[model samples]
Target: MISLTSPVETRAHHWRAGIKLGALCASTLILFFIQNWLFQSAFLALVIVLYLLPGWRFFTHGLKPIKMLWPFIVLVGAWHWWSNELQQGAIIILRLLSMVALANLVTMTTRLSDMIEVVRFLTRPFAKMGFNTRALEIAMALVIRMTPVLIGKGQKLTWAWKARSHRRSGWRILLPFTVLALDDADHVAEALRARGGLTNND
Candidate 1:
């Protein structure tokens, strides 16, 4: 799996996963409750500062996945502009950026194993009550691990299209991308089966 954990070490990396996760949850909930653009902007600026405190390399690495949010941001802004609600739009966009960037920061500084362990510990009571925690843990891990892989594959497909055509790849690559994703999923299923993967009765 391609680890999202940043290579440029920072003090945040040493913090406990549970604590960081807890703070992330609280911050996310707080963001949803805020209606003022001024406060939302302030919170987002603080998040940006937090990203910068880790130095240039770490900041850039953390920023990579956050860039994916741009399309959604643009969509939200356009809808709100058409409705003439720029204040609400600013609040929404700022909140979205702040929350996702903060989550990405946590993911980049924390190990996948550590986050998994944190989830496991938190869900122990439910596990004892008959929930299949192992399946959930495996699902979470695979989602985190495969997300970047899919993103990279999409980029490669886009590049391949660009190399062969004069126009932008745009929606034309969707058919091939869908096929590639299905093929990847088939391979992953086979690999999991080889490892004696989860079943409901497990």
Candidate 2:
């Protein structure tokens, strides 16, 4: 579930992880600052085009995690439609989708170990002070890797509830979602233990 890296290679894959991450940050900041729906929509279109450039398999593989964002998309669209603020909603949703898709694009292309190297570089001072920065590095890796996995679980849980009942699942999925996340965490912990990876001590 935590397979953040895609098998399909792109020119983006050959880019340095630090550069990709830096560009992601810059793009996200730009997206956040712009409130124009047209601009946001353009940005999103560019991201989609980037996804498409790697061919269908890579595009589809990259899109799976992005598709998990539909709930928020629905909520934002509905709320905007209800309040007659569709313009504002369009801007919000477009920004949301564009930033997330770009972030996903970076993760899909960049290797996890390369990302860890970036984290290590950023945290060099902590390591030099005799602090166990390995844990911090691993924690960062887990977050980037598991976020999409958990979101996929949430999407499945939502579908399951919708299939069984007539009402909206809303907050009801929280408990089950938490349980599923914890279960995944347990499995991940076991895997890490098996690899002697859970320790912070140097």
Candidate 3:
């Protein structure tokens, strides 16, 4: 698996996974209560500073996932502009970008095994109630690992569309992207079954 954890280590990498995750959750909740664009913008700036503190390469790598958000950001901004709710749109975009950046910071700093252990600990109560959590843990790990892979595949498909046609790719690549996603999922399921599925002991 391609590890999402950044190769350039920072002080944040030393923090406990549970603590970082707890902080991320608390900050995200607080962002919902904040409606002021000034405050949201300041928070977003603070997140950017946090990224910079990890050094240049680390900062750039942390931002890679955020590139996928531009389409939604543009759409939201355009919608709000049409509705004359630009302030609300700005607040939403800033809040979302900041929270996602902070979350990405946590993911980059924390190891996957550490995160899985944290999830296992959190889900222990449900496990005691006879619910199986191994699948849940595996699913979370797969999401973290596969998101970038899927995004890259979509980008490649878009590029292929552009190469073969004079028109902009835009939504034209959606069908192929969906097909690729389904194919990847099928392959993943087959691989897991071949490996006897993810067990609690894994």
Candidate 4:
């Protein structure tokens, strides 16, 4: 499996995963309380600067994940425009982009194992209450790991559709994408079973 963790090491990589995650949560919460677009824009700029602190190559690599948000950005912009609430829309878009960028930054720097351990620590209380959190942990890890894979697959499907047909490939790709996701899920399930699944004892 291709690792989502960036190969280009930065100072942020040396930071503890728990601290990075805690900061992300706190920053995200504070973002919601701020309603000014200028403030939001400044925050976004600060995030971009933080990304650049890792050097040019790492900064550019960090941006690749943000491209996935273009669709949501466009949709939100359109809705706000239609409602004649452009300022509100801009604030929303900026907030969303900033939060996602911060999250991507954390994921790019932190190792998967570290993030998983943090999650396990967070869920310890629930686990003590007779709730099985092993599956939940596995599911969270899988979702984080598979998101980029699915996005790449969708992009490839779009390109293939474009190559074979002159017409624009729109919703037509959804069926194949769904099938591809299901196929991948089946393979993952098989692999997990072979490895004894995610049993609590394991």
Please say which candidate is ahead in lDDT: 2 or 3: 3
List model 3 lDDT by residue over 15-46, tens digit each: 99999999999999999998899999999999
Instruction: List CA RMSD, all candidates.
Output: 2.1, 3.3, 2.1, 2.0
Model 2: per-residue Cα lDDT over 104-191, one tens digit each: 8888888999998998888888888877889888898889878877878888999999999999999999999999999999999999
Report the C-alpha displacement of residue 51, candidate 1, in angstroms.
0.8
Residue runs of model 2 more than 4 Å from their true location after superposition: 1-3, 129-132, 148-177, 190-202
Candidate 1 TM-score, true structure as reference: 0.94
Candidate 1 on 50-168: residue-level lDDT in tens? 98997887778888888888899999999999999988998999998888888888888899999999988998898878887888888888888888999999999999998999899
Estimate every model's Cα lDDT from 0 to 1: 0.87, 0.87, 0.89, 0.90
Decreasing lDDT order of the candidates: 4, 3, 1, 2
Per-prediction TM-score: 0.94, 0.80, 0.93, 0.94
| Candidate 1 error regions (>4 Å) | 1-3, 199-202
Total clashing pairs for each candidate: 0, 0, 0, 0
Give the winner by TM-score: 1 or 3: 1
lDDT of 4 at 118: 94
